[model samples]
Target: MKAPDFDYLRPETLAEAMDMLSRHGEDGAIIAGGQSLLPLLNFRLAGPERLIDIGRLAALKQIVDGDGFVEIGALVRHCDLASSEAVARAFPLLRQAVGHIAHPAVRHRGTIGGSLAMADPAAELGACCLALEAEMSLQSVRGQRWVRAVDFFAGIYETALAPDEILTAVRLPRRGPDSVQIFSEVARRRGDFAIAGLALVADNHMANPRLALLGVADRPILAEKTMALLANNMAAADQAIELIGNEIDPAEDPAYPPAYRRQLVRTLLRRTLMELLP
Candidate 1:
């Protein structure tokens, strides 16, 4: 299917893109790599009157290391993140998660900000962001604001972003020396959307770990209680599984039934915890 008629604008500057978005409001959609939006447009699931393409905005395509955080521009592609030495060194969870997203071709065109903004429940980036405790930099003609990952995703395909706002960057806190990271997911076939996935980042000594699950809920589900359970008694893996199953309300989908998904969560949680072992 071909996309409906729409006006396209490739703005060279961030201000220009913001102006176009403000003018078009809900009728306009932001296109980064077009990896996700183009398919939605072709399927007629999204019909926008205007498209604000920020793919050419070089200012939005950088990855920089801050004192305590790593900043990734919204336009940074998955392939870039996967290959980045800085990302590999400081954000192993993100690098590992990006390596599993779709495939090489898709990674070349998929942007980190686009995936998070889309808020797909089965996306690795969303789950990684939650586990990393990342923050997003949002901008609009009005002003700019930062949103924590915990507060950014409202539901599946839903976010805190307004129609005229754009996500410009994502900030991930650098893992400390004692941090251990793990990421695992199961799909029907390689490169397919996950049936279930898990990402875990913990400082065992500090007893603060972030446990997040995907493909088991409407949005990426942050399992604070499950993390606490694991931290308290890493020996009792069954307790972690039971806590996750009882806490997360997974949806029934064609890929897997709700019961199967709950079981997957348990299995993945156990495996991830095992990976955290010294």
Candidate 2:
């Protein structure tokens, strides 16, 4: 099915785009790469009155390296992130996770901002964002504010973004020299949505770990109980693995049941800990 008719407004600048969004409010939908929105539009899942196109706004396409974090502009394509040497050095897990986002064609067109805004429960980037403890830059005609990755995701296909606000960029903290990143997912096939995926970032000894899992809950979620266990003592692998079931609330699905997902999470946690801890 084709998308419903909508007025298309292309803003020449980021400010103009925000202003348009502010005026239209709930009636408007922002379109950058359109990789995520177009599908919804085509399926008639979303029927906004206006399409505020920010695809040509050059300001939101830059990847800036900062003192302690890398500010990746919202419009940066997945392909760009997958190929970036800077991203590889600063956040290798993100670089690895980018490889799991659809195929090259989709990666070439899909934007990081689009992925984060879509907030798909099974998407790799959202899980990576949580593991990296990234911050999202939200801007509107009113003002700008930063939301941590943990607080940004509200639920399935939902976010903390106000209708008038746009996610301009993401601030991903650089991993320390002693840090290790582990990313693995169980997918039916390559490029398919993950049945269960884990993104774990921690030190060599598994201290101060940040573990986020996808396809096991309503949103990419942090395994808080498991992390707390590891932080308290590095030798709590067996107990931490058991806590995975408590931390995540995976919905029952015909294809991937909650039990299967819980087991996958346990397997991933156990396997990664073996490699990292000893």
lDDT of each: 0.88, 0.90
Q: To one decimal, what is the Cα RMSD in angstroms of model 1 from the true structure? A: 1.3
Error of 1 at 74 (Å): 0.5
Worst 10 residues of 2 by lDDT: 269-278
Can you list the residue pairs that collide in candidate 1? none
Worst 10 residues of 1 by lDDT: 202-211
Question: How well does model 2 score by local distance difference test?
Answer: 0.90
lDDT of 1 by residue, 1-278 (tens): 99989998889899999988898878889999988899999999999988888898999899998899999999999999998888888888888888788889999999999999999989999999999999999999999999999899999899999998999999998878878888999998888889889998887552677888998888998888887777756776777778887777776678577888888888888787766567
**What TM-score do all the candidates reach, one by one?**
0.96, 0.96
